[model samples]
Target: MSKKLRLSSLIVGDAQADRVVPPTGFTARLTLFAAGAMAFLTVFALALSLASGRLAARWGAELAQSSTLRISAPAEQVGAQTAAALAVLESTPGVASARALSAEEQRGLLAPWFGPDLPIDSLPIPQLVEIVETEEGYDVAGLRLRLQAEVPGAVLDDHTRWRRPLERAAARLRLLGLVSIGLIGAAIAAMITLAANAALAANSQVISVLRLIGAQDHYIASAFVRRFTLRALSGAFVGTAIGALAIFLMPSAQEDGGFLTGLGFEGAGWFSLLLIPIVAAVVAYFATGSAARRTLSELT
Candidate 1:
């Protein structure tokens, strides 16, 4: 539309209107600082959201496909119950594989709590069996019933208690990260709006002179919108770059390092960071435009 083209031209460069707003001032610095700081925070928030999502998926998939069986019996019956549990699991439909952990493996599991030198044999440690499930996963209730009848000491743990809580925690963390990003965006908009209002108020004398010279309100407002939007875009770009660099320089994720060690983008995830500046620009466009128009109307 003709109106759209005219507006775009004004934003692109209206030499006459560009002079209306001072090129550098306190408002300019405020808009730049707010956008930059918020964009930096937005990057971290996005990283946290992505990391939490991956963590949730991993916990859901890994835990759902696996479970544990603990056998607590008199020293004489421990081996018998463990063997019986393993046999039951092997015969169960939908079981992919099952194995009774060796004494050494069990010692490794307990080493963190009891120390490596602690003699595992001296303790009445319950035998543990690891079970992996097929895509159609074994029926937990049925499996429990079978273990009860054949292996009296066997207790089946489908990891339901552990999995549900972990998944819920990861999901809630992801939600919180997303909410943080939204709040950051709103904060940026608020800051830009305030800066725009301040800039407009400071230039009322110039605006009055321009109005006397027949400058349309839309043309005057467009100059302020374009300037503030560009400032936001540039500031956000710088902030995003710095934040991403900081993330990249962080220690690489190691399998042993756990979730906290991997709080950064992975592969395609880096591309998502590029949107931060663009989003900031759009937020500024609307915010500054609204503030400019309102301030201009009040001035008249």
Candidate 2:
């Protein structure tokens, strides 16, 4: 009761008390290493989340706005079917434009498989017509029915077969990134709690002396909280800086134009990384406070 009154007085009287707990090197290093490691992993998780989001948006927008038409028929009927498919697409309400791909364009698409010197004219390859949709988009079922009725050889493909899988993959990647972040937070909390427990165990004499000298539980806990929180903040800062530098050094998106290689921050994403240290500090503060209070309460 006397200790509580003294603590209340310390708060209300705005008086500073002398530090009662001596710091241990082990807990300091442990907290620093744990916070730094977690923060480093968190940076990569954040990058994965942001990059997957961008990929999802790009795939949705690009794939949703366009479709393809493949016309397979006899040499004489290929041109007529292509024309008929174009007419059907043009008269459609939601379609923005439909143009048959030229021979050169078709040959270029097939070049990887058939080689550049392969004679495109000798082969009876299907004619491909690209279809662009308006902002409102087109009725895919209705367009397919119209194409079947007008041109039997014409097949309208909305690219749904390919787009759905890509979208699902991107969504799963984003979810994985989020799960990683949650796991990282849990790891940080657990590590900080262990470090706090170790510190409390090592300074049993110091805690007993403070209690014998009329120190409140909050006072003792606050000492541990402040020390661990500052350590976590400093460690997270260093880790975040190193992670950001590593991300910056990664290959640019323009270099290879690959999704996995372009894993890094963009625009406001860089600013979001600044919150990592603050979050680490808060986590440390709460984790250490809880552990310290529990340890102190268990003492005589």
The C-alpha lDDT values of all candidates are: 0.88, 0.86
TM-score of each: 0.79, 0.82
lDDT, candidate 2, at 261: 83
Candidate 2 CA-lDDT value: 0.86
lDDT, model 1: 0.88
Candidate 2 residue-wise lDDT, 253-276, digit = tens? 885387988799999999989999
Give the runs in model 1 whose Cα sits over 4 Å from its true position: 1-22, 72-88, 91-93, 102-127, 145-153, 210-215
Alpha carbon lDDT at 79, candidate 1: 80
lDDT of 2 at 234: 90
Report the C-alpha lDDT of model 1 over 108-194, residue by residue, as the tens digit. Answer: 998999899988898899999999999999899999999999999888899889889899999999999999999999999998998
Model number with the top lDDT: 1
| lDDT for position 101 in model 2 | 94
lDDT of 1 at 120: 86
RMSD of each: 3.7, 4.4
Model 2: residues with Cα > 4 Å off, grouped in runs: 1-18, 74-76, 115-123, 212-214
